[model samples]
Target: MRKLNKKLFSILSIVMLLLLAACGGGNTTTESNSNTGEDGVLSAKFGVISYLTGAGAAYGEAITNGLKLAQQDINALGEVNIELVIEDSAGKADQALNAAQKIMSDDSITAIIGPTLSTEFFAVAPEVDLNGIPILGTSTTVDGIPEIGDYVFRNAVPESLAIPAAIEKAVERTGATKVAMIYGNDDALTKGGFEVMERTAKEMGLEITTIETYQEGQSDYNAQLTKIKNTNPDLILASALYNEGAVIMDQARKMGIEIPFVGGNGFNSPQAIEIAGDAANGLIVATPYFGESSDPKIVEFNEKYEKEFGKKPDQFAAQAYDALFIYADALKRAGSSDREAFRESLAETKDLEGILGKFSFDEVGDVIMDVTVLEIKDGKFIEFE
Candidate 1:
């Protein structure tokens, strides 16, 4: 009878211990269930959507490279451990929407970092905002982005600011009076850029001799280039992705259009020169980041990036790096990775010095930063000033 009682007691104790473990015992919780841990440290999860396998893959590669470096640096601080789940948008709107939907379904993701392009943001941001998830864009710079909702934000300076600066510099450098404009008609980014350039050209007292529109993936620009060449303008203003822009530059030079080309942020990559070769030698574009800055912060980042990636970082990499740090800083300031608290803290960001420059989000969620005029000389980007 004594042995039987002891065995029963032991079984009961085991059952109670199992129940307590199942119920978490008030101190242990799964990573997906809470942002706080037993040790009271922030372990937040984030999602990144970038075009890793399409025409915009160059930009996406740079963005993710920078993100990985930032993650390493931020995690090393020991106060915060950030884990990023990356999604490839493939430069497609539907792909971006699918990626964002997958991220929103996961309850653990505190914030999302991209959709890569302005057009992708237009497609995916509204739905993400409706789900109450915050998304910060690293390279999306077209107008009306942050206005999608309070949940959407971007670090890229808009075309409204960058385009005018580049155009003004082009006009000043070449004394260009008449200009020809070429743009991709099917995409929001290129279309918006074209509109900004048109208005800016008029404001700068430059005549638009001819305006030509091409489809996004059209390889043959002979018709458009021939028309633009007939105008014999002093310079050409282009709004296009690197692929199409490079083709345009190559075709323009092959057809004997030798005037200097002034472009927007889309042309801010070494791939342009890789494709256009000598045609891209004197290309002038305005961007928020100059990889060759004398600033110590910029120098350190560039050196590290080159050593790791075997190439110099571009504006996209710099912007994505800033975006991740901004998010992590907001997480620290809030002291909680809860969505509402994090969003509030992110909104209060002011005059934060980033790799690009000093940047802060305006009330509309657009980044306010200085645009630097850069001219591509000898296959490398150099400050125009």
Candidate 2:
């Protein structure tokens, strides 16, 4: 009887030990999957939706390069490991929506960056906000973006701010009393830019000689340019993507229109200069970043980016680079990859020094940054003094 009792006790003890071990393993697994690894390093996954293979490819490429550089730097810090899952939106609103949906399906993605243009943001941001995932726009700069939801954030300065700043500087420089405007009426970015330009121009008491509109992919602007040229305006205000803006400037120049062009955010890319060639000279735009900045941070970023990408970084790249660091800071503050926690932490960001100067978010997740007016001179963007 004693031997039989001992055998029963032994089996019970073995079962209890096995159960405890299983529970311990389960706890470790959960911890590993949440925020920290067994090695005590923080980790998170980010999704990027960019217009990688379309008319906006230059913007997307710059954004990607900046993010890649930031990723490398963040990983090298030894505090966190960031894994980027990038999807090409191809500059389409529908594709952006699909990419956002696909990215949100991954429960591990803590946050998302991009959908490059504001039009795509309108499609993807609302859905992502409903899912409670933080979506940061590195390049979407239209009005009413942050109004989408609490989850939507952007480092890109809106046209409401940029256009006015550019116009103010250009007007001061040229003492312009009249302007001709051309804009892409289809895209949110360009349309928003035109509205701001018109409003600002009116408020400044500058007469608008003509207002012409075009679609996104339109190549020829002869009719509009002809009307603008006939007006004999002191300046031209263009709200278009880089490609369209370049073509318009080239055509306008060829047509003997010698007025300075005050352009929107789309003109911030170097591709504009490349496409327009001499026409790009005297082109003016407002940006949160200037590659010619003598600041140590800006200089270092320019050198490193030029070395890696074999070209200078533009405003898009600078903003995207700053965005990654912003995410990293939020992740560190949250101490976990919980989406809500990250969103809250990101909202608290203030005065973070970046290549774009001191970066912060307002009450509604809109960027609060200083703007610099720049002009294309001899195929380079120089600060408009």
Candidate 3:
């Protein structure tokens, strides 16, 4: 038993070390290519403005991996020479705006990939838009974010679509006639999902008996869940980020509430499973990509990703991968490096082949992705047929 404990300790230490290493140096590796074309023609620069450093760094790495793969393939064709200039949009609004300013100051970058989060995207949008540069959000799904700028487009499904399906899942499968809405009220992304969950649940005839909210970094969710328990709703619809989701799920399990738990897209994460332990076994959520997809394209991507990253890639990572390839497809279809033409070409995308469903951006710049209902069955994510 002592030897077993020691071995477990060693494994934990190694895992922690790996995580630290991954967190340390990220997205700092940029290609030092200094080649360029003639002055009159299109410059071969694509700006990747993303949260590639600090808190949202891992998210950026996933995106960077996808972008790098597409860039490599496109350049390998030898038909078009493209240089991806990656920039880190860290810190707050001011810092994000500064990054946009820097990207714009350099006239080389044809288009930008992301600011990652909706809040930061809003801050950077005006600057990038004023310069007539189009920004593609790889995974920022918050509703009403399209108002940030006309030049911004999203490759991920809007929160409105995914969150509603989750609500429907709860109402139909769990028989959740009365629900208590819980969410990270402080964040724009989380709040957007929460609002949709509320509206959709109401529309689907599920009574929202109570509403509970929490700010990020508040350790105890007991107070919020306490309110939820009082209402005695059939289930809780949590619009949560992965960080706080574990806490709520853990607390709910400890409270002895066997009524199933469901959450939004952000809850479809590995951390939620680790933190929720056995409680997460039955947890359900809505998402665009299923890590367990049996599709040939998904299998191919999964095999390649597992070989490179040494683990299964999450839906967030898939969004990043699909977004880059989608943009590349549009650029090739447009047949011109003209920035205006590229943006217009992106708008014309319809049912284009992609890793995450098809590329069909709606009028609001949100991708019309096929949202799937997923549940944690036996510690593994399985699609709800």
Among the numbered candidates, top lDDT falls to: 2
Q: Which structure is stronger by TM-score: 1 or 2?
A: 2
lDDT of 2 by residue, 205-236 (tens): 99999999999888889999999999999999
- How do all models score by TM-score? 0.85, 0.86, 0.85
Which ranges in model 1 have alpha carbons more than 4 Å from their true place?
Answer: 1-32, 37-39
RMSD of 3: 9.9
- Cα lDDT of candidate 1 equals 0.87
- Rank all candidate structures by their lDDT, best first, as comma-separated numbers: 2, 1, 3
Q: What does candidate 1's lDDT look like per residue over 266-348, in tens digits?
A: 77777898999888877888888887668799999999889988988888888889999899888999888888888888988
* Candidate 1: clashing pairs of residues: none
Candidate 1 differs from the real structure by a C-alpha RMSD in angstroms, to one decimal, of 10.1
Pairs clashing in candidate 3? none
Provide the lowest-lDDT 10-residue window in model 2: 25-34
State the lDDT of candidate 3 residue by residue for 321-350, as single tens digits: 777766776677667666788788887878
- Better candidate number, 2 or 3, judged by TM-score: 2
The model with the greatest TM-score is: 2
- Model 3 ranges off by over 4 Å: 1-43, 77-81
